[model samples]
Target chain A: MNRKELIGQIREKKSFLCVGLDTDIQKIPAFLLNEEDPVFEFNKQIIDATREFAVAYKINTAFYESRGIEGWKSLIKTWEYLPKDCFSIADAKRGDIGNTSEMYAKAFFNIESSGMSFDSVTVAPYMGADSVKPFLKFPEKWAIILALTSNEGSKDFQYLSSDGNMLFESVLQKSGEWGSKENIMFVVGATRGEDFLTIRKHVPDHFLLVPGVGAQGGSLDEVCRYGMNKECGLLVNSSRAIIYASSGTDFAEAAAAGAQAVQQEMEKWVREL
Target chain B: MNRKELIGQIREKKSFLCVGLDTDIQKIPAFLLNEEDPVFEFNKQIIDATREFAVAYKINTAFYESRGIEGWKSLIKTWEYLPKDCFSIADAKRGDIGNTSEMYAKAFFNIESSGMSFDSVTVAPYMGADSVKPFLKFPEKWAIILALTSNEGSKDFQYLSSDGNMLFESVLQKSGEWGSKENIMFVVGATRGEDFLTIRKHVPDHFLLVPGVGAQGGSLDEVCRYGMNKECGLLVNSSRAIIYASSGTDFAEAAAAGAQAVQQEMEKWVREL
Candidate 1:
């Protein structure tokens, strides 16, 4: 779950891709609803279909959140079905007051606490150190802070000049000190590939959870070109582009094919690493 | 649900307090566990109990997300249960790439798209303008960006120098331009009460969703001193200190009492406005 172990998995699989399990009920084929928990069934099938090709599973809490209680149970069941070697992320962008954040950390990282422990959770750094540090208090549990997101809005403030440097650069420098490279990561959206070089100049060694690939139209070659590190530190996520490849009975197969294509592409990158 | 109407609700309530519905399962009274969906039931009772006294409800998505599907349903149901006059918020700190963010916007603001529509969502402005603009696509919905938080690490990066301006200051000034005051709000932690004065200098007219007032020890008087505008452009939230006021069967009564106390203090400030 730590950086070294995470990197090792990519090296072993020859794939650095983290398939985002942003399973939307509406998006998944209607057939799965026949199962007790449609979301869990869909996730289990996806994990079974793609585990061999993926190094990590990033679950976006929003997709399940839109569903409510049953959705949460499905999320838990999906986590249960995921293999241990593949890193698990809550993909829950959470940050709050220190005391409250401690509870959130307990929920996502502590097996004794929530029963569903994720290796990492995406944290909003806007609340500052206390909000992010609570997640870091537990060693080996990574805090993926939002830096230069690929979204167009990233240009709104991330590039604003304080004097000479941009705002994101300041976030990169200051948040970097809150934890070690082993525990801290940045969410550098894949669309903003060019900024990856600049981002690396700030935190050269930490992992970057590069989202916005595939369905979001971010270029894989460009991201790897500007974002990759010596350790192959990048978890490029593709959700909609892969998971919902088909809406019929062959959906799982289609998903597998989609994952295979990305894995094949990543295999090339891994060998180069 | 939009800013104008939300302002009207605040004026009607003679209070600008938006009690945070961070309904942590363990924190709720054990009696609620007997219900089919304990979190939902707890939120329903709390909403019903506090509806007449408050103008807005800020549901921290983390509490529901940690629980998974069922939690999400609870959040949605809670949203539906709130009085129409009260503004409903998905306190989900979401920001992603352009296309991905478009989906998030659909999930939160657009009823047909997200299934459950919330009036506003809390967003982390780390990614800049594009990440935030996607949220603003909905005419009446809002994008509440993080400005100054109350956490310890707030100093770590939020105040870090970027060129000559503080990073948070740059975020406030730069991000404030992306949308009009109607749709763009800022999250200024109540724990940083006096600092709100400085933040307001940058975002004077926009609304603010202030946390840290109750359980986090943020003083209402201090926040009102430097933060409140003529329109009472503030929705101070109190989560744990109110919702978890007691764990016994008297939980709902306790929550109402807790909410009333904050509302009373908030009313004092509103009278001046």
Candidate 2:
């Protein structure tokens, strides 16, 4: 799916919240431990319950990855179960050499090999174009590169003066040339708060995947304030704050409620594109 | 272990080849494929076979992660099995919020719930200091941040103009201030070859985890020429070229041969340091 369709879903649902499935095994309801595929069961229930309030589902591969083969299968099964209209993300943070990346692209997007496919995948741009180009090669597939993240360490090197410019700013301006706004995006953490304004100056149209809301305390209002564009280009993610909302048997319902709250707030903040 | 200790091991072994344990399920021999934990068994065999020859083992979380819970367990077992003197890299590429990062550090280095304890981990600096700092907070544990990658799409923004500095150059200089040379390291792709000289100018004292040799065609002569430091601060990583050296039952032995070939070349190169 492309950027337009992503935004269209938000408009259709009047919500912009992207449910981040950063599921932790130990935190899931104790009941699931007895199930054959506990991870898949947890994801299935959460996805089923939260599908209504979210426009996107961002799966952090680490949580599933920490599990291994069974985790990979869970990821595949979960992807298969997600609604077709909702944008799917493989938050794998994959970026390697060109050839390896090509295979990664094939692994995630090639539906023939695995029935699971993600519309976008988070990529680390430290490898430069060759690393990122492989992901963007698919006509409609999107690559959300890391930009000015909202972490304190972002101040360490991203903002460091290299030659004369900061690294994150350089990433924003240079990476912008590889693809149009419709195909590329940036991961701008909401926790950093004000960095969004400067980020907007670099790529005014591309969507920004903003995480760090809820538990991390990144204000949703501030993220939308400086980051939003005429395209309504922002996908604010909340993970632990949603998925683990409640650890009881009603975990799925509680997650849906947490997701609903974010959607309600997003409905008021979304720009009229 | 800190940079000095890792360097000592490299010198004692007279090798810089850090064989990467990036085991994919499909890549393992057919016999082990039916095991209770194919990934862990494959890793055990490889580690046992290569432990004498390799200076370190970098466990790229992606291959294990593509699996989920089973993968996490395998990661724990691999870390446990790894020799203490040998540098154990989580290769998780994790960088998140301060609190979350602290949790990650605990998961990898602290022997609490996660029986895994790795010496180092790869982190994406896009989130800045808070994301990177939490990892650094652990006394001897280190953070291997991305500096210059060898991927195709990296040109997208990594080299873009921010005044005159390239994005990666800026990150290197900035992130250096976060931790002492004793703890911080950079991931400079070997494919960049001579660009190592350029990276060295920015981080002359810190260790570098260089990936992309062998299958990626990154030459040992070229990378060592520009990458080697006075302290011999270079942990050259070879994944596919070494781990997947053969598809047959003799894969582990073939992998040892591939690793030995690179180590022989690396031995010659280390003379300059």
Candidate 3:
């Protein structure tokens, strides 16, 4: 999905919510285990329940990869099941050298080759420009580079100061030159709400995929206040807090309730735009 | 493989050569395409030929992942076919948050879960300690962290000077505390031969998995001179140069000859010890 279409969806839905399907087999409702593909079954219901409120879906690849071939099968099926109108993100933090990265691009952005083509795939910028440029070769596809991540380990190397700019700030500045706002986005954790102020300074127009909300104790209000752009340039992701709201037969309904509550809150913020 | 066993293999084989099975479907011989599983068939031949000289086999996951389900099938088969005596590495440079990294660890380290158990897995260090620690949870497994890579883009963020050390130097310094020399390793590219002098300073005891030789124009002599230690702490990798040595029917023999040449050079380095 391109920037304009994404903004349109957010405006129409009145929410920038991107539901993260970090579905673990062990965490799903036990009854679902009786099904042939419980992981896919769980994702199908979660997508159906949250589709009304979300404008996008982010599938964390690690959750699916843990099951080997069976997990990979579920991942392909889940990708096929995602709502077409909603932007899709393969949250596979993948990057390598130029040639190898081309293979990764084929894996995620070329559905004919990899059986799944996400609108964007999360990329680690540690390997630098060539590692990321391959994903941008596809038209309208996005490369969401990791900036200031929400995890505690984000402090390890991301904050190292160089030439007065922190490592992530350098990532934001240097990577901005590699792709425009149309093809590039940054992953800015919502936990550090004020970091958005610093983030906006480098790439004001590019969308930021915000994680660390809900289960991670990040406030949606603070994210909206500091991160939201006129185009609603913030994809606030909520994974566990919404998907695992209930592990019983009522799981789908509970997920819908959780999503609706966040959507309603998001509606208030987008309404200002 | 543990530290002692890996060094023993290097000494036993009289080589520290790591043959990178970056097997691309398009690059394999056309006759192999007639087989039930061409990619795996090609890899099987390459491994059979190179097994004698190589102490390690590094499978670049991107090549297999590009083909989707069939590709993943090939990856598992390739992993299963790997010689039990040689150190196996799933060169999947994956890293994420703590829980997500745990899932990745299970994907590569836990055979019961992911259908493939590699001795080590390459991890991108952009997310820091928590993202890498999970891989170390498994006894006798290793996390080969990306410190300095071997591409033109490596200059983008890796060389950024922070305080008294460069970004890659800081990565080595900080990450050294995350795991011991036993469970931890760092990828120091062979292209920048002199950089090994600096890398050895921070990680004198930990093993360095060196890529960028042959196909990438790195020198084996220079890598050994500056990077080797008492245990000959280096696993130098060559992918395209050795694997794709020939495109005709003589491909396997050519690969054997190519691997033997590198092993001979490596033997000289180990002989000095």
Candidate 4:
């Protein structure tokens, strides 16, 4: 999806929520185990329940990858079942050398080869510019570069001072030259609080996919206050807090309630804008 | 495999050469396309032909992942077919948050879960300590962190000056505290010329996986002269120069010759050690 279309969905839905489908087989309802493809079945129901509130779906590739071939099958089937109106993200933090990275671009952005083309893929910035520019080559596909992540480890390297700016600040500043706002975005953790203000100074127009809103204790209000742009350019992702709200028979209904509550909160923020 | 076992393999084989299985479908012999799984069939042939001289095999996951589910199947089969005497490295270049990195570790380390147990997996160091420590939780497994890469983009962020040291140097210093030399290795590209001498100052004991030898124009002689330690702690990788040496029916034989030539040069270095 293009930036304009994504912004349109945010306005239409009154939410910039991107539901993360980091679905683990062990966490799902026990009854679903009898199904032929339990992971896909769980994702299908979750997508259906949260489609009304979500502007995108971010599938964490690790959950699917740990299961081997069956997990990969589940990933493909889940990708197929995702709502076309919502942007699909392969939260596969992938990046390599120039030629190798081109293969990764085909894996996520070229559906004909990989059988699933996500609108975007999360890329690690450690390998630098050439490693990331490969994904931007694909038309309408976004490259979400890691910047100031929400994890405790973010302090280890990301916060290092470099040439009058922190490592992540340099990442944002340098990566901005690779692609336009339409094809480039930053993964800024909501837990970073005031760091969002710092991130905005670098790429104010680019979309920021903010994780750690609910389960990780990041406040949506604070993120919106500092991170949101005129285009509602903040994709607040809530994974476990919404999807695993209930693991019993009422899981789907409970997931919907959780999503709706966040959407309703997001509606207030959108209204203010 | 543990560090001792890996060193043993290097000494026993009289070589520290790592054959990179970057098996691209388009580059393989056309005749293999008629097989049940052409990628796997091609890899099986390459592994069988090169197992004698190579001390390790690094599977670049991007090549297989580009093909989706079928590609994943090939990855598992390739892992299964790897010689027990040789070390297995998953050149996945994966890293995430604490919980997410655990999943990636399981995806590469836990054979019971992912049907693939590699000795080590390449991890991007942008996210820092916690993002990398999870991979070390598994006994006998290693986390190969990206230090100074070979690509031109390596200069973008890795060479950034911070507190009298470069970004890559800081990475070598700070990450040195996370894991022991027994469990942690760094990727110091052969293309970086004299940077290997600087890297050895921070990590004198830990192994180094060097890429960009043949196809990327890095010299093996220059790398060995500056990078080799007391135990000959280096796994020099050559992917395209070995795997795609020929596109005809003689592809596997050509690959064997390519691997043998590199192995012979590495044997000279090992003997000097």
Candidate 5:
């Protein structure tokens, strides 16, 4: 999906919500286990229920990868099932050397080779420019580089100050030179309230994929207050809080309600902007 | 796959060679493509030919993942086919949030969950300690953190000076607190000649998975002189050079000859140690 199309989706839906499908088979309702592909069935229901409120769907690859071949099949099926009007993200944080990275790009962005194509694939930036550049080679696909993650471990290296700037600041500034706001996005955790101001200083126009909202206890209002640009450049993601809202058979309805609540909150923010 | 067992294999083989199975379907001999599972077939031949001289087989996940479901099937099959005595390394540079990282750990380390159990996995450290700690949770499994990489992009943020140490130095010191040398290793690129001395200072006892030997023009002697430790703590990887030595029908024979040459060179280093 292109930037204009993404912005249009946000404007039309009055929601910048990107529901995360970090689907764990163990966490889903036990009744679904009897289905042919429980994970995909669960995702199909969630997507069907929440597509109206969500502008995008982010599939976390770890859950599928852990389950082996069957899980991988579910992942591909889920990708295929995702509403075409809504943007799709393969939340596979993958990166490597140039030649190797080309293969990774093919895995996520080339449907012919990988049997799945995501509009964007989250990329780790430690390998720097070459590792990330491969992802940008795909037309209309984005490379959401890791910057200022919300995890407790973010303090370990991201906060390290160099020349009066933090490590993530350098990631933002340097990575900006590699791709435009059209192609490059940064994953700035919603938990980092005031840090959104800092992230904007480097990437004012680029969309920021904000995790750590519901289950991780990040305030969506705070993220919007500091991070939102003229284009509503933000994709606030909520996984467990939305998908696993209730463990009972009313799971799909409950997920829709949870997403609706978040979308309602997002609508106020989108209107104010 | 523990430190002692790895050293034992190195001593017995008289080499610390790690054969990188970065099998590209397009690059493999055309004859194998006619087979049902060409990638797996090719990897089987290469592993059988090189098992005698190599102590480890680093399966580059990118090459397999690019092929999608069939590629993933090939990955599991390759993992199963790996000689039991030789250490298996999944060169899948994966890391995420703590809970998500646990799934990644299960994907590569837990045989019951993913149908593939690797002795170690190459982890990207951009997500920091918690992301890495999950991998170390498995008994005898290793998280080889990306410290100083061999790519041209390594200069991007790795060399940024913070306080008194470079970013990679901080990665080494901080990650050391997470796991012991038995469970934690660092990926110091072979191309970074004298930088190995700097790496050794931070991690003297820990093993280093050194990539970029042949195709990328890294000197083995320079790496050993600086990075080698008491346990012969180095796994030198060469992919394209050994695997693609000859593209003809005698590809397997040529690969064996290529691995033999590297092992002979490595034998001299082992003898000196």
Candidate 6:
């Protein structure tokens, strides 16, 4: 989805929530395991329950890849099942050299080639510009480059200071030149809420895909206070807290409740816009 | 394969050559397309021909993933077909948060879960220790972290100097503490021959997976001169140059000849050890 459409969706839904489907087979309700494709069934219900509150869905590819061919099958099915109106993200932190990266771009963005075309795919900027540019070749598709990640590991190399800018800041400044705000977004962890001010200084207009709001203990309010642009340029993701709210028979309903609660909270923030 | 076994293989084969099976469906011979599984068929031939000279086989996951389900099927089959004696690497430069990284570990290392157990998997170090540690959990498995890459884009952030060391240097220093030399390896691109000297200074004992010779214009002699250690700590990879040696019916023979030439060069390097 383009920047305008993404903002419009956030306005209409009154939420910039991106529900992350980091669905693990072991974590799902036991009864669902009796089904042929439990992972897909779980995702289908989660998508159905949470779509009302979310403007985007980010499918973490690692969750599906763990099952091998069966996992891949579930991933393709889940991608097919995602609502077209909602922006889709294949959270497959993929990047390589120019030619190899082209194959990755085809894997995620070319539906005819890979049977799934996400609106965007999360990319690691470690390999630099050529590693990311392939994804930008597709019109309206986006490349969400990892900036300041939420994980503890984010400190390892991301914070290294060079020329007075943190490594992630350098990532923002250099990668920002590779693509425009229209086609590129950055993944800035919500846990580092105040860092959003620093992030905004680099790419004020680009949307930031924030993960860590729910289970990872990132404050949504702080994220909004520091990160939100005039266009509400933020996609705060909540994965475990929303999807695994309950492992009971009413799991989908529980997820709906969890999403609705977050959405209601988000509604209050978007109201100022 | 453990450190000792890998070293033994290098000595036994008299070569430290890693044949990269970056098999693209479009690039394979047209006659192979008539087979039940063309990509797999093509890979089978390439493997059969190259195994004698190669101590390792690096499968670039992007090539398989681009075809989606069928591609994944080919990957599993090719993984199954790989010679058990040779070190297998799922060159799927994957990294994420802790839980997500665990899933990725299972995807590549745990055969029971993912149906493919590779000796090592390439990991991007942008996320840091936690993102890479899970891959080291499995006994005898390895996480080949990306330090300096081969592409033009590597110049962007990798060379960024911070605290008297480049970003890639910091990655080598910090990530070196995550796992022992036995379980840890770093990808020091062959294109940057002189940079290998700097890389050796950080983790002299750890093995380095070098990619960029031949097709990428890296000098094998220079890589060996600066990168090699007492154990001949380098698995130099050549992908397109060796795999796509010929596009006609003589492709397999051409690939075998190409691999042999590299192996002969590698033989000279290992003789010193």
Model 3 segments more than 4 A misplaced: none
At residue A105, candidate 1 shows an lDDT of 82
Q: Arrange candidates, best DockQ first.
A: 6, 3, 5, 4, 1, 2
User: Residue by residue across B159-238, what tens digits does model 6's lDDT show?
Assistant: 99998999999988887579889999989888877898899999899899999898888999899899999999999998
lDDT of 4 by residue, A11-86 (tens): 9999999999999999999999999999899999999999999999999999989888888899999999999999
Give the 10-residue window scoring lowest on summed lDDT in candidate 6 chain B: B171-180
Q: What is the DockQ of candidate 6?
A: 0.93
lDDT of 1 by residue, B73-183 (tens): 676778778788888888777876555566677767766644678888888777667768888888788888888776666776677665566777788888756788888
Sorted on lDDT, highest at the top, how do the candidates line up? 3, 6, 5, 4, 1, 2
Q: lDDT per prediction? A: 0.80, 0.78, 0.94, 0.92, 0.93, 0.94
Winner on lDDT (3 vs 6): 3
Pairs in steric clash, model 4: none
Per-candidate TM-scores read 0.84, 0.79, 0.99, 0.98, 0.99, 0.99
lDDT of 4: 0.92
User: What tens digits encode model 2's per-residue C-alpha lDDT throughout B11-83?
Assistant: 8888877889877787788889788888888988888878877888998765654444455567678888898
Instruction: List where candidate 4 sits over 4 angstroms from the true fold.
Output: none
lDDT of 6 by residue, A1-273 (tens): 888898999999999899999999999999999999999999999999999999999999999999999999999999999998899999999999999999999999999999999999999999999999999999999999999999999998899999899999999999867999999999999887789999999999999999999888899999999999888999989999999999999999999999999999999899998
Docking class of 5: high
Q: Give the per-residue Cα lDDT of candidate 6 at B200.
A: 92
lDDT of 5 by residue, A173-234 (tens): 99877999999999998887899999998889999999999999899889999999988999
lDDT of 2 at A20: 85
